[model samples]
Target chain A: MEMIERYIYAVTQKLPQSQREDIGIELRGLIEDMIEERVGDGEVKKKDVEEVLIELGSPREMAIKYRGTKRYLIGPELYDSFLIVLKIVLISMFAGLGIVFVIQIIIDPVEILDHFVGLIVTLVTAIPQVVGWVTLVFALVDYYGGVQTKDLGLDKTWHPSMLSAIPDPRRRIKRSEPIVGIIFYVIVMVFFAFSSNFFGVYVFNDGGFREVVPFLNEAAFSQYMPLVLLLLAIFIVKECLKLISGKWTMKLVGYTVIINLLGMMVVSFLITGDAFWNPEFMSDLVKSGIVTEGSEGYQIGETIWKNSTRIIVILLLVGLVWDTIEGFIKARKK
Target chain B: MNEQEHIDKLMLELRRGTITIGVLSQLSVPQYGYSLVTLLNEKGVQVEPGTLYPLLRRLEKQGLLESLWDTNEARPRKYYKLSKMGNEVYEQLCKEWEGMVASLDHLIHTRKDEEDGND
Candidate 1:
């Protein structure tokens, strides 16, 4: 009896809950009728039930069969549409987070980016992220009818409906990646070289660098930034590609965003010059253990939240140009 | 049989079956799913549940069938019958089917006589 019930539940598992109980009962009756026709009625016991089910086929297959075919937009129909929306949303979310981070950075002890640049950056990041998320949700809902099971693992053949992802064609001819990578790399190298003490801008220029950097308060940020900025920008681009192309090849974009934001707290300390290590900040978090880095958590979150916004836009524009160029080149060849 | 032969059989039955006539004739009166299934079954043509359901859905989607959920009963069921457009299409199918049958029958019978003489 238990086996029979298990067999029935297994078949009905794929079906929606609303229909499961009734369908289960009706199907069991049908199965019983078929069993009776095959064997004597009530002669079959629990041991024979599994055999009957095996002959019928896998429960998942039966469930799929019973649910008559329905066309999916993400499958073959609106696959291109899905990619367009995913790009827009992922970029937008990044932008929104960046604005919030910038605001927090400014509000904190050290101020950077003259008021206009700061506000502009904040707004620029906020708008697209909001728009991207809105469109993404709307498009997803319209296509899937409010049933989405988007898996974001890095290793699988599982293509999200949006991931009929074709390889970008211009990867060969354009060679923009290397140049862009180096430019980004150079930016980090410059930041670290001057920010760190050895070739100190402040020491040499007698505080000339102080006037240029709107906010530079922490020693660690001063020390770590050259390495940090290069890493952050490259990571952002990688995350955006993963998201837009539906590659599942890395950590969740959210996780990356949060982790990178921690760099902001490191910067926040640079801005405030609040010592290399805040014992109270570290100890309370380590003691209360709510978080090992309490105030610093807000700082990282703020950084991520701010930079993500700009990074989102930069990623989208770069990705769009990259894809478009790749697409154009492929089209020319074809 | 080969695909061609199967298709020929299906086409022949469809031509002779008077579905255009049967459908249009029935649509003059409002009919629902179970009622329509019963009507076809009584006429000695059996429509499988899967085929009937999908066909009904497709027809409704195509604006050829107008349907509304009639939930007054203990179990809610959707009733479907032809739309105004479906009526016109049904008329067209009836005319086309008659013309096709007349031409095919004339050819077959004439060919049969020729073959008989040659034998």
Candidate 2:
């Protein structure tokens, strides 16, 4: 009798609150009738009740039958899109972390082995956290019947005419390219912000490989950090847009041209300013016996180093103009 | 599968579709869940208590069956009977079943004649 009560409780608990009381009453009546039929003239016993309950099968299975079907964490309707979003998040996170680790190792060779293990552990832990959060968000969407693919305003609105809007094969930006670019720019921004000394040349001495020549004046670099960060932010946003569209559009090209121009202006301002490069770097080269002071080699090296900024600014401007023209040409192609 | 196993599987599938009509036909007279199972079993259609109870609840929910608790007895029992909608549905289902059975019978008989001619 106690077993029968427990069995009824198990089934009813799984049902909705509104139906539980009615179902419980009905189930108890049915079970008692079954026990009576089996008992016949004999006294009611635990074995008789056990036999009837076993014949009824497990409580969970019975509850499932009453409840209709099994539940899903992420149902089929949203499963594909959930996977796509998860892949994008995970791949970009890992790629960004990997590039940062590689750059850190290059900057500080002593901590190579230590940081490698730390990097792996970080990626391992971060992946599951990212995956779990993404899955939970999608599961909530699925539960609310919000996984309508048509309402997403992309695939559902596709038409034969839309084919003309597709970027030319040769001009199309691969998704991986933009993802890599975004990750690289993020690493560059973090590096320039925190570790200015890491951008110098490494020289092998009696001790070990050490950065003897600092390239950029740390104070001056710090002053321009805000501009550098803004440029990085713009680059990241542009790459993300490219990643989502999976191709170059005229709008994307316009954004690209604007970002490049802004970046060129920042670089030109930093280079043309007298405080950009470390004057000590050239003096350090003379002291290290790599070049003698006032020698032809020293003069040529300094001139090239000073004018290298101008050369780079010119080259970058040319590249930006060419890229803008290419974007327009691709947008106009059949 | 061997012959008996194959037949058992086929019979199970067939019985699944027929169980609703079988229970509905007998429920014209008031019967509790266990009583209905016993009645159907005695008539040679073995209805499991687990399957029958859930099905009765489902039918009651669908408005095809009406149930009441008979608490006058020493033990209370919930008795189910066919509703007016249930009776009409049952009659229609029976007519469809008869038409299907007649057509199948004729098809089988004609197949037997063709086999006899070939022999």
Best by lDDT: 2
Clashing residue pairs, backbone N/CA/C < 3 A, model 2: none
Q: Top TM-score: which candidate number?
A: 2
Candidate 2 residue lDDT tens string, A1-334: 6788899999999999998987788788878878878888789999999988999999998888787753778776567656666666666676667766876775577899988987888777877876776677667656654444434544766777755545568668776776677667656654665557657666656765544567778877788888877777676656655664566677778777887778778877877788877878788877766789999999997998778756766887787678677766875565
Question: How large is the i-RMS for each model, in angstroms?
Answer: 6.9, 1.4
Candidate 1 lDDT, B16-98, residue by residue in tens: 46543564556656675556655887887665332344455556667887877666854455666788998888878878878
DockQ of each: 0.04, 0.45
Q: What's the true lDDT of residue A313 in model 2? A: 69
lDDT of 2 by residue, B1-119 (tens): 89999999999999989999999999889999888888999999998888888888889889999999898987677899999999999999999999999999999999999999999
Q: Please state the CAPRI-style docking class of candidate 1.
A: incorrect
lDDT of 2: 0.78
